[model samples]
Target: MPHDHPMTVDAMLKQEFWEALYQRDDRIWSGNVNVNLQTEVEGLKPGRALDLGCGEGGDAIWLARHGWTVDGADISTTALARAEAAGREAGVTVDWLHRDILSWRPEDAYDLVSAQYMHLPPALRRDVFTAAAAAIRPGGSLLVVGHSPKAMRQFDGQKPPEELFFEPEEITGYLGDAWQWLVETCETRGEGHHTDAVYRARRLEA
Candidate 1:
């Protein structure tokens, strides 16, 4: 977030915080797909996918172009609108939903459920991750990517409290034994100051 932006815990939980963020900038994220998402998913079988906190739909759009049927969900109307426009421009259709993933309930209906950079208070984040995991069907995958706490802590006042960032175990622990780890670790985001903690797991087929 920009130093001008307030990132209080209370502010982050409210939809207005994100709406205001989008309102402040025409485009906050790089329109290209996130690096971890691409590295982990590029060759995986494309299927039904739910993009939790889809942001501007870069990942969703890319997935659609690669053959996945995707649903993009986010809390900000501003972001969703941009995502829809981008989808249209890209000539791919994605079901976009206006939703706060923190409280959103989803079924075990997607072959993949992805949550990228959706940071929150750890307790709330566990709820968010559990809910997202529920959306993945048996034999499906769950992919989560977030800023690594270890490196992000160097940001001083610019970043959210260290508590808001996470370690790989902190994320993978949100899953029950029904899931098997595919990848669980952190890699430099290449910014030299930032690292990405990633967790990719597959729901065991019963």
Candidate 2:
């Protein structure tokens, strides 16, 4: 899925790009947690969780409120600040880590690891997703939600190269079938073709 993009991967990976993105406005993402995430995780018993690319702390905060101890991490300092404030406002405490998830590996395993809409080139995405899978303790789950390639037309073709978009199979194939495929659905967001590819798999217990 690596192809030519108007912006190089290096540019997108830099903290400056994300910092500028978050600094552009008081908020970047909707403060609410992602619908796919909540729908898939709402029934699970709360445990330690990790939210990668956890912009604005919405998912992490939501998880904490639901009784999971959460560590929310992102590359942008500005985003982290906003997330911290939001977590405080929501009356939930989240341990926020500022680091580039592309290269950072979690030191502790989690009962669940979620990455929502963290689109990157397919190669880089595989590495990050692999690490996410590794960070899950046995019998835990990994949830990945992405902008399905089916919805690429909704992006106005301005940002996030098409190469970054993917279908559910691309993710399920990478880490192998060691996981039980729990959820594989392309949810329609609303009218007009907007959709999200949601994938959730539970790690097979040893």
Candidate 3:
């Protein structure tokens, strides 16, 4: 069993925290897609995509390389800068934005809007999840990811214990009648560092 520790968002976003975490020689969380994200989104064609909480730009950069016009957003300037540098190095163009998603407003609709591993307090999670669902154009999709309930004990990083993790049913509850569920599942990855519930839903045409 892991040590019981207090968890908070403020504790998670300390300066140089995530950068130091990702900049390691091994690329522990470097911007790469593990099995979960790729398997779920493999059929998605390159198009307008919003990568929320896009740390180090791995997934966003990958989408761009595959032909998506991606806007990668993160609250960390350091992470965004590193992602920009990585994009340049990879010869891919990705728009990096340093903004908090809590206050972010969509200027235009997108074909795909993704929030991977965004663990917000209950209220904020609902707000953003709803907003993301609404931000999709007709026939567009919303992809949300968060650690699974079982992940609490296994994955050791920042997120609260599995008790605080939201399940796919909880997420679908938020969608209500606005969108149709395309996919939803809970899985483990990353040598036990990641246990996540993935949600993929498409807005129904009016």
Q: Considering every candidate listed, which one attains the maximal TM-score?
A: 1
Q: In candidate 2, which residue ranges exceed 4 Å CA deviation?
A: 1-8, 154-159, 176-193
- What lDDT is reached at residue 15 by model 2? 82
Q: What's the ranking of the predictions by TM-score, best on top? A: 1, 2, 3
Candidate 2, overall lDDT? Answer: 0.81
lDDT of each: 0.82, 0.81, 0.71
When 1 and 3 are scored with lDDT, the better candidate is 1
Count of residue pairs whose backbone atoms collide, per candidate: 0, 0, 1
Per-residue lDDT of candidate 1, residues 1-206 (tens digit): 54455777887888888888888889977789988998988867999999999999999999999999999999999999999999999999999999978888885499989889888898899899987777777778888888876666533256677778887666666776643544433343544456777878887777
lDDT of 3: 0.71
Q: Where does candidate 3 stray beyond 4 Å?
A: 1-6, 13-28, 154-164, 179-194
lDDT of 2 by residue, 1-206 (tens): 11222355677877877777777678878899888899999988899999999988999999999999999999988989999999999999999999889899899999999999888988899999989988888778889888877776533245556887777767766555543444434343532346677788787667
